[model samples]
Target: EYVTPGGYELEKILNRGSVAYTHVNEVWPNVYIGDETAKDKYNLKKLGITHILNAAEGTWNNVDTGAGYYTGMDIVYYGVVAEDITTFDLSQYFFSAAQFIEATLSNPQSKTNKTFN
Candidate 1:
């Protein structure tokens, strides 16, 4: 979460965008089946999230739990990689950050996109 200039709480940042959900397996953990009520309350539709990148293998089924509820949503699963902390490279993550900036600049809703640079 971030604090705006006026101190209002903003959405949490993820890959340079405001993420509606984080650590999908933890917070709302189990995917609820046969329940449209939860989706309505969560406001997932209003958030305009069009993709889901599942970092778990067997958990793909869990995301399927929300399938029919949303239209035109894309979900892809890339299995997690176990790595030692001592050898991790932080720079690799920056590419995603750069891509996020590009996405925001190209977004139709962005004021920056409307202005002439």
Candidate 2:
């Protein structure tokens, strides 16, 4: 069984982690988490971006470019149509998205980014 940590324990654990205020961050080699600007075609081309996982799809607080936007660009695209909200449960996309990210980062020449809206 797992001992569930709660209240101040959880807060303490969470507080130990750090986050930055940057629009784009390279968390691992060839792997990136980027905002709209980073996902721009020109920027992506400059960055040599090989794959893009769009976290914000549709029109509501989203990019709405869809996969077709990257056609003929040698960039692979995957989209998760989601709203950026506190109540929007995104757990459903976690596994598949992770798989996609894993596949994207597996190549030596890969420059993968997950676009944030």
Candidate 3:
């Protein structure tokens, strides 16, 4: 799920076999996800975004090239962070919808190590 500042929430639901799954997530006020390359960075920066959180995963060599390029232009690059939340398990955790939403909204630091140039 992705949400913009205007209260527009976009959700992608997946149905697999006997399971239906939806990820509850939200974006910060003006952060953006770029393409597999860096095309979306320009448009996002033009829209006045000062920080970018990338949820993609890989080696630093793979992730930081784009992050470094964007940071060079003065954007605050936050991720290339980890994708898993180890605290919650989808099959066994019986959290209320509100509780689940609250948990998701909490910003936890990534377990992945970040490298700097």
Candidate 4:
């Protein structure tokens, strides 16, 4: 079985660097990782994004744009109500998140799916 590194070890790696501000990065073709600011409709249009997977949903320090938020837009949204706490066990959402992303990516009509991880 795989074990998560101890909190001290994880903290050492996490706190090694200061927080850096950056624009959304395209880690894969049509896939992105960015802050909540990337949810703007105009920006998504400009970037040619067709789908968005929000790993962090809800109103707590996260983008509040659920599916209903993009009314009349051609974009598709997938969301997971995730917390930023270390003890939250983010792994629980991994499979579902991957399935959503895969579905979007595999859709022949979907040219670009931008996921905000």
Candidate with more favorable, higher lDDT: 1 or 2: 2
Off by over 4 Å in 2: 1-20
Best by TM-score: 2
Clashes per candidate (backbone, < 3 Å): 0, 0, 0, 0
Name the weakest run of 10 consecutive residues (lDDT summed) in model 4. Answer: 108-117
lDDT of each: 0.31, 0.80, 0.38, 0.69
Better candidate by TM-score, 1 or 2: 2
lDDT of candidate 1 over 1-117, digit per residue (tens): 332333233333434565454322212212211222223424333433333322211322333233344444332112222233447453554566445435543644421100000
C-alpha lDDT of residue 65 in model 4: 68
How many clashing pairs does model 4 include?
0
How does candidate 2 fare on TM-score? 0.76
TM-score of candidate 4 to 2 decimals? 0.71
lDDT of 2 by residue, 1-117 (tens): 345666898687568866555667776678888887434788888888989888888778657777888888998888899999989888999999999988876887888888877
* Better by lDDT, candidate 4 or 2: 2
Deviation from native of the Cα of residue 103 in model 2, angstroms: 0.8
How well is each residue in 1-117 modelled by candidate 3, as lDDT tens digits? 444424232222222233332221113422223433333455444455454444443353334444666755665444444334555343332244334334433534211112211
- Give the lDDT of residue 29 in candidate 2: 74
